[model samples]
Target: MPTISGAGFVVTTLNKILAIAGVAIVLGGVALGFRSVSAGGTVCGSAFQPAAGITPMSCDNALNGAGTLVTIVISAGVLCLIAAAAVKVVRDKVNA
Candidate 1:
């Protein structure tokens, strides 16, 4: 059986951990988006409703900001997953 050096093992573990965290973050972001839409709809009425002074300014801002935040969080999670994958490829090549 081949043995990995301590540092290599640590790096591999960290990469796996990062991948797990990325997945968790992505799921959390998705949940947040769903919750925001449901809660926002309940509070602000249907989005299909006319926008002429029907929805409060605060509700509009909150909904918009929530969307932006979800985008940012999901993007970050994707980046993390990509980074972990890249690292694994590089590590494999180096060990090969």
Candidate 2:
């Protein structure tokens, strides 16, 4: 059986953790968005709402769509995973 080095295992584990966190962040953001719409508000306060008419439905009306904070969060999560993978790749290349 091939044995993995401690450093190699640590890096792989870190990358996997980052990827998992990114996925969690994305899913949490989506859940939050749905909760916001259902509750007619958001935890982000007025920030995620429109410039005016900052009412209960503001978060729902704005963030429930694709072009809103939810999308940004999901994109960020995907980017985070991509960055982690890139880092792992770079590290592996350097080690090799």
Model 2, residue 77: C-alpha shift (Å): 1.0
RMSD of model 1 against the true structure: 4.4
Task: Please provide TM-scores, in order, for all candidate models, with all chains considered together.
Answer: 0.77, 0.56
- Model 1, residue 76: distance off in Å is 1.2
Q: How accurate is candidate 2 locally (lDDT)?
A: 0.66
Please name the candidate that would achieve the greatest TM-score relative to the true structure.
1
> Which lDDT tens digits does candidate 2 get at residues 8-96?
78888888888898989888766655543323433423323433444545455444553466778888888888978897898779778
> Candidate 1: how many backbone clashes?
0
Can you give the lDDT of residue 90 in candidate 1?
A: 88
lDDT of 2 at 6: 95
